[model samples]
Target: MSSKNSFYSIAHQVNKPENISKVLPYYSGLEIDIAYSASKKQWVVAHHDFNNTKHYSLEDWLTSFKQLYSKRKSKLSILWLDIKTLDDNNIKDMLSTINKHIPKNISIIYDLGRPLNIINKNFSYKNIINNLREIDGIGCWITKEDLNLVSKVKNQLITDKVKNTIISYGEVVDIDLEVLYKLCEINKNLQSPFSKVFVWNIQYIEEIDELIAWQEISGMIIGYKKQMWNDRCLDQLKYLNDLKVKFNRNTPTTF
Candidate 1:
């Protein structure tokens, strides 16, 4: 890996084809919500449950990404697939479809809810991860609701032997530096699972600074809005080049 830390600044929910050209040039990647359409028998780029609501095909979205990627050939683009409706029967098809459309510059990080959801009969989390590995996809570890479940989460990661996970940064208010510190400690001891951490729901550039300065985060997924990319914010983002530093293993990585 390169000595310079690889930090991804992603645009969240840029699911439409029209937005791809606008957003790809400014960010490292795009986070797209996908749900399987039973009626259409194909994956659709949508955040809500299946309905008549306007949504583009997953193929269309990936096509748009590929076109933009061809222009920005050097950029490493990640497609964070937040699967809204994943089930056992449709997983193989979903993976196959993604493999066909995903471009060379694109990397995939998929989220399928809790890996150990006992009530979810859709599919085993580990099984989906294994399938994703076949397509060179990275699995994600979403932070849970109860703060006390840290130990349990650690055990799960150990059992799965999952390295290089994308972590979901829930509501900023719900998390503080303390929780992020503990997560870093877990990653430190575990050695590799959390080596590459991507946190979503980041609204401000200062939050980006705080996360990067602390050293645990490798990526930031900012919710997409035109005004969010104001002059000050863009300047701060550009200043991140100066902020980039090598990963510090000797010290505890903060949030």
Candidate 2:
């Protein structure tokens, strides 16, 4: 795998067909909220609150994504599916739809919410793993408020039979470096399930610098806005690319 880290922009800002063209060239990945529409009997893209009346079908989004990725050809674009709801039928339906549309060039990462609620009559972690094992990875969201729950969930995932790449979304206040360091340390000590850690909603570039300095973290997920392609964001992307090159050069080869 390339040592270069990736940047993922939240997809809601670019939910429209026309906006896809604008965001694709700048971002390496798109984090989309996956919600089930029982009325439509199809999955749609919407935030956790599910309040937004405008719904973008997952299939439509994937089609646009495939085209954009083909055109870009410079980097592997990622699709982070932030699953808002999961049941046996919906999980199967979601995976089936994804498998049909997912291209080889695009990577997939599932954000299966907290662990405690994952296993029940309708859904099981094993089932989710079996479905996603062929894809990129799977993870859960963690905030400072629920650190203990996150740790337990991570531990359980690590112990699972299928050893897919594990990732954690660190949702914190102001990109707290100290909190990030502690999270990494906990993962290392516990034989963490995660191979990557993504700090969400970062508003500034200095957080990226701090994460790179730590060397344990992997990437950042920036929330997309109208001005996402502005000079500041572009400069930050350039700096990350440079850092990736420097790190790759410094590392020794393992035959």
- Identify the candidate with maximal TM-score: 2
The global C-alpha lDDT for each of the candidates, from Candidate 1 onward, is 0.58, 0.59
Q: Candidate 1 on 99-126: residue-level lDDT in tens?
A: 7877754567777555445123237454
TM-score of each model, in listed order: 0.75, 0.77
Report the C-alpha displacement of residue 145, candidate 2, in angstroms: 3.7
Q: What TM-score number comes out for model 2?
A: 0.77
Candidate 2 residue 65 C-alpha distance from true site, Å: 1.3
Best by lDDT: 2
Report residue 249 deviation for candidate 1 (angstroms). 15
